[model samples]
Target: MNTPPSPPGAERTDGSSVRIGVLAPLTRPGWAEAGRHLLAGLELAVGEVNGAGGIGGRPLQLLVRDTAADPRKAAAAVDELAGLGVAALAGEYHSVVARAAATRADALGLPFLCSSAVLDALTEQPTRWVARLSPPQSRGWQLYADFLLGAGHRRIAVAAQPSVYWASGARILRDHLAPRGGTVIDLDMGALTPTAVCDELVDRRATALLLLVGHPEPAVSIVQSVRRDQRLTESLIGAPAGQPEFAEWATSLGDDGAAIPFLRYLPERLSPLGARVGAALRERLPEAPSFVAFEGYDTITVLADVLRSHGPDRALTADSWPHVAVEGTRGRIQFSRTPGISVWQWAEAPVQVVDRDPAAPDRFRILHAG
Candidate 1:
């Protein structure tokens, strides 16, 4: 159960292996598949690195732990991995888990890099032990705002899960709309009843909706409610999670709603690295892939690069490296310089507006591409 020790350049002078821990949601209710997808990406990265003669010829090993989207589990997992003496820690899509792990990592003085968690609060701590490789939620909001403003939607309603990311984005949207003579109506689903959500949307008379739910049921319910009562026919809908399932929901509600999904990378086509990642994922899980996959891939890639460049002996603290710029499956990645530094420079891929075709429920047509 002994973990790998750090060397001068993350190299093993004594033939010791470098253990990097990946903490993710493996058994969470709606996120099991996403967790699998993320693991698939990590597998590709490790396999590729090991196949290419390992990190500094010492072979890199991944220690996988299931956080189950639980903060306590996340903290406990870090304790276990830390006891094993892992050189570094990598985070997942669960921001709460990232926050918890960051706290522990900071206390232990271990370098922590976040791959997918985008909540701004994770980086608000005063320590330089954590670095986020994913862009902040604010950037995503700016993208959504730009998209909405360009589409001529002046009156907008934001429907979110009342999570950290959504709540922050709602405020940013409201602020951004203030100068343009536009209106931003905020809806926190966690506080209001589903029926109340429907009533509020109808009352706002908003011309567009920004949905922030991460699952299928709530998303579908919101759409149905909006369609049944709210005058959203002429309004545009934007979400970061508007996948095929949401389109199906729109069709089920008999609403030909326009949808825009703000994703991590632009261009729907896969990159060379993405191709390798996809193949690895198909072999491992063979189900639907989500944005978490890319997050995991980028996390490992960046960690490997840093470990290789810095070697095992150099301290891998957060302040040890101010920024990381890597070419991922999407594009260039640079961590944000915000005071708390919650976001990363992971290039958000182009957003596309898609609609569910009445003739083909499972199919979607791209009306716009960013």
Candidate 2:
């Protein structure tokens, strides 16, 4: 299960099928369960590509490895896939898991492409073999910051989980807000009790709140606590990929409180993509509660574009590898090289402000695109 050589790109075994390793958290629980969505997207991409006559005359042979959303496990899965002689890798939703895949790919000389790891530090290296379809969290924060400042709201309170992506966003917000003479208080929730954290934000009288947590239930708890305990009535802005439970949670607020989730792709008016994904997941995957299916779908679509441009070349040559270009669910993607010798990649893509809880049936606005 760890290492199985897939069909080579140039061979006739299975008539030219290239093995692409898909590392995801198929066994994890909770809102992080969005790994299934990541898988679905990747599988969908493969199906579409194969249906169109495959990549480089070779149909994709996907070898899925469950990272279980664990860093060490993810690393192990990467090694196993490398042993299997997979041509490339695509699918890493978490920051720690993405870094693990990037590191192992560098050592093994394999191409590692992440579907959705927004940490800025992942691409600080000379490893061009590693790429990410998801834009960094800093870029996402920039979009949010610009939107907030443009709307004439100078004072902002930042609340984020103590994860690498959130930490990076917090730092970026500080740098952006300070230059404009705006005050930003770090409402870091990773260290404090949920109740205490809500109380502080409520007592502070903030003009706006930024929710940067990853999982949906934790975010739901935060929203519930903020409303129940803090008695704070303020607008919440966050990256669309932050949590999928926003619309349902926001709608439950009964029109008084709004949860404006910034997203990679907004659902159609009166028909959000999340709702559709949620329904499909409910039937197909009753065991898995929460999964980021769009993340999977988006990542695969982007990686396929890279493969389309650059055929199934095993050797990851720096100069020859074409930059990943794809119209993903998150809009346009242009990954850039990082300065340091790290495994991370960076890109600044356009983001849309999706009205998770539409006041009207046809009221989904793309407030600011990226």
Among these predicted structures, which one has the highest lDDT? 1
How many clashing residue pairs are found in candidate 2?
A: 19
Name the top TM-score candidate: 1
Per-residue C-alpha lDDT of model 2 across residues 208-309, encoded as one tens digit per residue:
667777444466566667666535655454544455333344444444235455655333321344455445545555343233455566655655665666
Model-by-model lDDT, in order? Answer: 0.65, 0.61
Point out the worst 10-residue segment of candidate 1 by lDDT.
1-10
What is the per-residue lDDT of model 1 for residues 1-370, given as tens digits with 9 covering 90 to 100? 2222222233222447878877777774425556666777776677788888877897887777777777787788788877777778885767667888888877877778777766667744566667776666566566657667777878887777766656777787788877977798877777876567766766777778777776565766766666566454555566654434332344445543434434443347778977767666667654435556766777788888878877754265454446666777766656545644543334443445455555754455554555
Give the C-alpha miss distance for residue 281 in model 2, angstroms: 11
- Against the true structure, what is each candidate's TM-score? 0.79, 0.76
Worst 10 residues of 2 by lDDT: 3-12
